[model samples]
Target: MRLSAKRHFGIALVVAGALMCLAGAALYVMPGPGFPVLALGLAAVVIGLLLLAALRRE
Candidate 1:
């Protein structure tokens, strides 16, 4: 079945968030400040999950 556009966007956000988290980890290993990126990634993941959940209810 074809997924809705909103669902696709949500999934993209989750994937992007995961990548951001990985980048943040690399930054930490390189002696840079990574907390902000990590926090933003976590937030994006949470928002994406919430969006998915909300769409599922419809």
Candidate 2:
């Protein structure tokens, strides 16, 4: 199963991505479930959304 969400290039998403990345990485150091990798992946997706939204801006 997959979930789809509308892309929105807002600052909030960017912040969330950064937070996720940092936290995930930290967790990874403490013997976690690929949290850093997951964070990076999520950040990448958020970045994509940011780009899409930015382009939409007139």
How would you encode candidate 1's per-residue C-alpha lDDT over 1-58 as one tens digit per residue? 3459899999989998988888887887888998788888888988999989988998
Kindly report which residue stretches of model 2 are placed more than 4 angstroms away from their true locations once superposed. 1-9, 52-57
lDDT of 2 at 50: 65
The CA lDDT of each predicted structure is 0.87, 0.63
Please report how far candidate 2 places residue 20 from its true position, in Å: 0.5
lDDT of 1: 0.87
As a TM-score, model 2 comes out at 0.51
- State the weakest 10-residue window (summed lDDT) of model 1: 1-10
TM-score of each: 0.86, 0.51
Extract clashing residue pairs from model 2. none
Assess candidate 1 and give its TM-score to the true structure.
0.86
Candidate 2 lDDT trough over 10 residues, lowest sum:
1-10
